[model samples]
Structures are given as structure tokens and as C-alpha cells.
Target: MKKIREIESLLGLPSPSNISVWWNMGSLLGFILVLQLVTGFLLSFHYTADLYCTFNSIIHIMRDVPGGWFLRSMHANGASFFFLLMYIHIGRGIYYQSYMMQPRTWMVGVTIFLVSMGTAFLGYVLPWGQMSYWGATVITNLMSAIPYFGTNLVEWVWGGFSVGQPTLNRFYSLHFLLPFVLSVLVMLHLVFLHEKGSTNPLGSLHHVAKIPFHPYFTIKDIVGVVLLSFIMLGIVFFGPNLFTDPENFIEANPMMTPVHIQPEWYFLYAYAILRSIPSKLGGVLALVFAVTYLYFFPVTMRMNVLPMAYSPISQFFFWQFVVVFGLLTWLGACPVEDPYVNIAPYLTVMYFALPILMQVSNSIWYKLIIS
Candidate 1:
């Protein structure tokens, strides 16, 4: 009880004041994480990790168990919502200079995100459906791009020449274990957050505007969670397949590839990069490095302080960059033939060139503002 009181007291300190509804994204993410875990636990009861039985087990759960259909639908669609909320949360962090003030918090949050992506990838392959199998094959094969030991490592991980039952079992095991690891990371993230306290919109340091976290932010978080849950349930009940690929409905057959083998929507950005380049090895390297490169943004950008806002030109470029990213996602879902292959390079370039453009625009804007 004493320890609890002490912790509460620390979190209750008055620091965050100008926080808006946008700040609720992190809390909302936490809520979605809990929801996913609960629903996933239920689904796992009926799921078999074996390739032969996995898809059948999923069907059994959907058709036989009472209210099982809703559970499975919610779990599947919930992943989409999870990524949506996470992107917004990460975007909010970027916009508000949160990372600048709380570097450790930002780094920890990024780490959690990367781990979550890995877990999602593993879970995606567990169904042993057509897309799951081919997606696993395509992604895992990228490891072969490594300089010397790549092919050997990929074979070792797959436990064969290609994705098979061994890969399915291994993925399932890691999928089950990763959420617990994510929970631990979330705890560490919160610890770091509590250390520095929350940042607000005004970007002030005087501690002028502050409120207790419990009654104020806690209630807000609850309201956000409730709203999100209502929307999620609506999707689960009405449009469960809206976010899923139709190709995944087919059973896995290694010999017969789907006309279009794409990953889950969350991975479309990286997938686009992988398909954009001409060389398989180059595409593989680009995809792997693209994400890992984000860690260097702070140092590479060389900005001592973060920008509060960008110039109109930079803002326009940023939105265009977003559109280009969406286009790449669409391309990723399409067959890797004409128009897609041709446009992939253009989209890929725009995807990476945005940050450079932002840096230039920032420099010009700051110079003009100071002058």
C-alpha cells in the first residue's frame, strides 16, 4: 500500500497542462493492447500451430464456438486498429517535439513498436493460409541477401529450403512469447515517461499549467478507450473482412502462388520498398535497413532542437509524402507487373526524399524567420 501510494504520488505531480485529445493516443494504444491480448488468448485456445490443421482450426472456431466468430474477427481487425493508433501516436510524438524532450522515452517507444511489428509478422504467418505461407516465404528469403552466411541462415530458420511446418511452429512459438516481452517493454516505457514527466503543447518549463494524472487524464483515457472499443466492435460485427486480403481465404499450396502475394497492410510500406528495386538483394537490404535507419534520425539530422512547426512548403511536402506512401501501399497489394514495377522506383524515391526536403525547408524557414 505504501509503495502504491508513493508511485501514485509521483505520477500525480502537476506538469502536463496543455495536453490535448491527441495525447490520448498512447492511452488508447494501451487499451487496444489489452483488448488484443484477451481476444487473442481466446482464439489461441482453438488455434493449432501445425500447418495442416491451423486453417481448419480457425474455421472451426469461427463456425462452431458460440460467439467465436466475433472473437476471431475482433482479433484480426484489432491488429489494423492497433497499427492505426500507433502511427497516430508516433506522429503526435514527432509533431510535438516529445522525442527531443524525452529521448529515452522516444527510443523505448520505438523499440516497443519494432518488437510489436515483429510479433505481428509472426502472428500473420501462423494461420498457414495462402498469403501467410507466401508472405513468410518472400520475407524470410530476404535474409539470403546477407553477404556470406545469408542463405545458410535463412535455411536454418525455415528448417528447410522454404517455408514449411517447421517455420510455422517456430513462428507460433515466438508469436506467443513476444506479447509478454512487449508488456515488459511497455512497463519500462512508462517508467521512463514518469521519470521526465509528460510534455504539453505550450512547450513551457515553468510548471505553470499542471494537474493530477488520476482524476484528469485517467478519466480522459477511459473515455477514449470506450470510444475506440465501440468502433472496434462495430467493425468486428459488420465488416470484419474489410481490412483483410481476399487472397488469404485460400488454403496454402506452395506450388500454386497467389496472383498477388502481399503482406498485411501494416507492412505495405516496407513491402513497397522491397519490390521497388530491380535487384532482389538490393530490395532486401533496403527493406531491412529502412526501419533500422530511423534510429539514426536524431543524430543524422543534426538538429540540436526539434522544430515546433514547419514552413508551408515543408508541410505540403510532408502531406505529399504521406500520399506517396499510400500509393506505395496500394502498389504493394497489386501484382508486381507493369505500372507497379515501373512506378515503384518513383514512389520509393519520394518515400525517402521527404526527410531531406523537410530538412532543407526547415533550414530556409528558420533563416527567414530569424532574418
Candidate 2:
């Protein structure tokens, strides 16, 4: 009875009444995490980490295991959904200045984002398909951009001159291990979130009513999860390979190459940024800076109010930032040729400019509101 009551109290934690569907995204992400864990575990039973066996094992899973295809599809598509929710969760945090109000929570969340990407990269290499082999080759080779020790670093990572069985074994080990690390970090994130309390869209909500997590927000999260399930289920059942690359259908060939060597869609924006630069080392650093920029958000500018409350000009720029992001994502999907090659560098400049423009807007608004 005592333990049960403690659990109920945790679930009944208080929150602001003004939160919208955007707030439910975190809970939806939690649901996807659980799905990934379950499916990944089951898929492990039939998988082999050996380079020669990896592709054949995946094919066997699809053909021999009773429900293996479903499991594999769910795991793959679940990753897609996981990233989709994370982008929304992170974007909402930025828009509402949640990072400013709950700095520790934001920090943990961003760390989890980085870890999740590492985990996904490890998982992508496991299929050992054409794209998997070349993608692994391309990404691992990026380490050679380091000044003096770059060649040694690449050798250390490859466990040889090139990606092979040793590399596959290491990636498989890390892919299995990182998800558990992610779970622990997620617990820390929730701990900080609960300590600081949730951020409301209007900034501070001292004047608003507070309500319990159970019955109200729990019910809201359930609704969000159900709606999300419909879309995920449709893709899993009908079009399992919709997001997969056709090039991956062929077994990995060291001698042959695909016409295009693109990554999964979520990484496309960063990939675009990586390709925009003229110098290899500079491009690698730019990719690093793109994600690391989030770490500096709290220190860049101090704002007393949320982005929405900051000023009309800030809000206007915010929407422009969103459109620019979409444009970058679109450019990422297109071939790195002709007009796109010229256009990407310009968009890359604008992408970095958005944050500086944001801080400028915040400065003007602070002066106007205070004076």
C-alpha cells in the first residue's frame, strides 16, 4: 500500500493548465522508446553481428521468423518516429524558452539527442547492406579530417584499413549498449524536469490554475499516443520500406557503388551542411557546430519572457527560421548538383544567421518593454 501510494503521488504531480498538445509530445516520445526497446530485444534473437552473416541473417529474419518482418519494420520506422518527435520536442523548447527556464533539463535533453544520434548511426551500419557499407565508410572516413593524427584515428575506428568484421562487431556492441545509456539519461532528464516544473507557453503562469498529472495530462497523453499509433501502424503494415533506400536492397559490395550515398532523412540537414563547405575539415567542424549550437542557447542571450512574448519581430523571425529549415531539408534530399550546389551555401549562411538575428530581436524587445 505504501509503495503504491508513492507511485500514485508521482503520477499526480502538478502542472499548469494552459499547456497544449505540444506538451504531450514528450509522453508520445516515451511511448516510442518503449516500442523500440521491445522490438530491438526480440530482433536480437535472430541477428548475427558477423560481416559475412549480417545481410543473410536479416533476410532470414524476414523469411523464417514468424513475425520477424513486422518486428524489424517497427524497429526501423520507430527510429524515424523517434527523431520526428524529438525535433518537435526540441523546437518547442526553443520556442517557449524552456531551455532558459529549465537549463538542467534542457542540457540533459540535448545530451540524450546526441547519444540517440550515435545509437542510430550504430544501428544503421548493422544491416550491412549497400548503403550501410558505404554509409559506414563515408562517416567513419570523416575522422581523417583531424590534423596530424587523423590517419591513426581512422585506423583505430576501422579496426583495419577499412570497415570490416571488426568494425561491425564494435558498432553492434555499441548499438546494443547505447539504448540503455539513453534510458538512464532520460530518467535524469525527467528528474530535472520534475524539479523545475514544466514551462508554460505564456512564460510564467502564477495567475493560472494548476492541476494534477493524472486524469488530466495523462489522459491527454493517451489521446496523443493513440493518434500517433494510427499513422505508425499504417506505415508498419502496408509500406514498411517506404523510408528505406533501394540501394540497400543489394548486398554490400566493396567494388560497386550507388549513384547517390545519402543518409537517413533525419541526418539530411546536417549532411547538407556538411557538403556545403569547400574544405573537408571545415565541413566536419561545421557539422559539429550545427548540433553543438544548442548547448550555447542558454548563454547566448538572456530573455525575461518566452519567444512568443518577446516581441512580434522575434516571432516573425522565428517563423522564417522554420521555413529556412524546411528549405534546407528539401535541398538535402536533392542531388548535390547544379543549382542546389550553389544554393546550399547561401542557405547555410542564413541558417547560422537565424540565432544571431534572434538575440538581436530579444535585445530590442527588452529595451522597449523595460523603458
Candidate 3:
């Protein structure tokens, strides 16, 4: 009864009354994560991690196992949905400057983001398709840029000189394990969130009245879940292949590489940043910094500008960042030549610079207001 009371209290915890539909992203993300876990677990029973057998095993699941196709489709599509909602959730946090109010939760959320990407990458390689194999090779080989021990680290991860059976087996095992880790991290995130409470859209918690989570936000979350479910199921049943890469449909072949290779859409922006830099090590570092840079935001943007709503300049830079992000994603998919290649480095610079500009503008706004 004590545990039940605690749970009840949590469900009824007060939330910002002003939080909009964007706040519903967190609930939707939770739903997608559970869906992915269930489908992934069911699909794993028949999956073979051997390099030679891996691709065929996937085919077998689709063809032979009852409802295996549905499970596989749901799992694959769920990943896309998961990232989509997570990005929106993170974007909402950024736009509202929620990080400054709850830095601990924000940092943990960023860590979760990185781990989620790692888990997705591991899962991508499990199918042992052409793009999957080469994607693993290309990404793992990036480790060789890590200086003296880089090559050794790459080999150790591969369990051989090249991507082979050991690589597939290890990736499959890690992929299976990381979701459990994500679940724990998620709980930690919620703990931190509950500790600080939700920040309102206006970014001011000062004397703001709160409402119970039950009927108000719970209904909002349900609406989001229903809408997201409609879209995700429509994709699952009508267009499962919409997010799939054509190269991934082919079996992995060491001798034959695809004319163009790219990761899933979620990764394209970072991939563009990687490709933008000319130096191997430099590009790898840029890619690392790209995703992990969110950690520094809380400290950098210390001004009392609760949200972008108060500052027009900061809002302008935020929109610019969003546009740059979209451009990078598009550039990442384009062939690495001429105009596209040239544009990436410039956009990468802006991508890193925009946040700094936002901070500067907001700080200026703060100074003027103080005077």
C-alpha cells in the first residue's frame, strides 16, 4: 500500500499549467520505447548474429515466423518514431531553456540521447545488410583516428582485423543489452525531473499555479499517444519501407560497395558534420562534439532569460539553428561532391556558432534590462 501510494502521488504530481502539446512529447517517447522493446525482444528469439546467417535470419523471420513481419516492422519503425519524438522533446527543452532550470535532468537526458544513438547504431548492424555492414565498418574505422591505441581499440571492438562474425555477435549482444540500460537511465531522468518539477512554457516558475497530472495532462498525453499511434501504425502497415535504405535490402558483400552509403535519417546531420571536416581525426572529433555539445548549454547560457519568448534575438538564432540542422540532414544524404560538400563545413560552423550567438544576444538583453 505504501508503494501504491507513492505511485499514486507521482501520478498526481503538480505540473505547469501552461505546458502545451509539446510537453506531451515525453509521454509519447516513453510509449515508443516500450513498443520497440517488446518488438525487439520477440524478434530476437529467431535472430542469428553470424555474419553469413544474419541477413538470412532476418528474411526467415519475415517469411516464416507468424507475425514476425509485424514485429520486425514495428521494431524498425519504432526506432524512427522514438528518435522523432525525442528530437522534438529535446527541441522543446532547448527553446524553453528548460536546461537552465533543471540542469541535472537535462544532462542526464543528453546522456540518454547519446546512449540511445549508440543502441540504435548497434541494432542497425544486426541485420547484416549491405549498408549495415559498411555503415558499421565506416563508423568503427573512425575509431582508428583516436591516436596510438585507436587501431587496437578498433580491432578489439571488431574482435578481428575486420568486421566479421565476432563483430556481428558482439553487436547483437550489446544491442540486446543497451535497452535495459536505457530503461534505467530513463527512470533516473524521471527522478531528476520529479525533483525539479516541470518548467513552464513561459520559463518562469515564480508564483505560477500548477495543476494535477491526472485528468489535465493525462488526457493531453493520451491525445498525443493516440495521434502518434495513428501515424506510426499507418507507417507500419502501409509504408514499412518508407524509412528504410535501399542498400540495406541487399546482403552484405565485402567486395561490392554501394554507390552511395548513408545511415538512417536521424544520423544524417552528424554524418554531414563528419564528412564536412577534411582531416580524419578532426572530423571524428567534430562528430563527437556535435551530439555531445548539449551538455555545455546549462553553464553557457546562465542569463535569467527563462525562455526565448522574452528575447527576440535568441529566438531568431534558435530558428537559424533549426534551419541549419535541417540543411545538414539534407546535405548528409546528398552525394559527397562539389556544392554539397562545400556547403557542409560552412553549415557545421553555423550549427556550432548559433547557440553561442543566442547566449550573447540573451546576455546583452539581460545587461540592458539590468541597467
List the lowest-lDDT window of 10 residues for candidate 1.
Answer: 301-310
Decide which is better by TM-score, 1 or 2: 2
Model 2: per-residue lDDT, tens digit, 262-327? 888888888888889999999999989988889988787675543566478777777787777778
Alpha-carbon lDDT, every model: 0.82, 0.88, 0.91
Candidate that would win on TM-score: 3
Cα lDDT of candidate 3 equals 0.91
Number of colliding residue pairs in each model: 0, 0, 0
**Which digits, one per residue and each the tens of the lDDT, describe model 3 over residues 1-371?**
99999988898888988888888888988999999889999999999887678899999999999999999999998998899889889989999998898999999999999999999999999988899999999999999999899999999999999999999889988999999999999999999999868989788655459888888888888888898889988998999999999999999999998998899999999999999999999999999999999999988877555368888988999999999999999999999899999999999999999999988898888778778
Q: Please rank every candidate by TM-score, starting with the best.
A: 3, 2, 1
TM-score of 2: 0.97
Query: Could you tell me which residue pairs clash in candidate 2?
Result: none
- Candidate 1 has a TM-score of 0.93
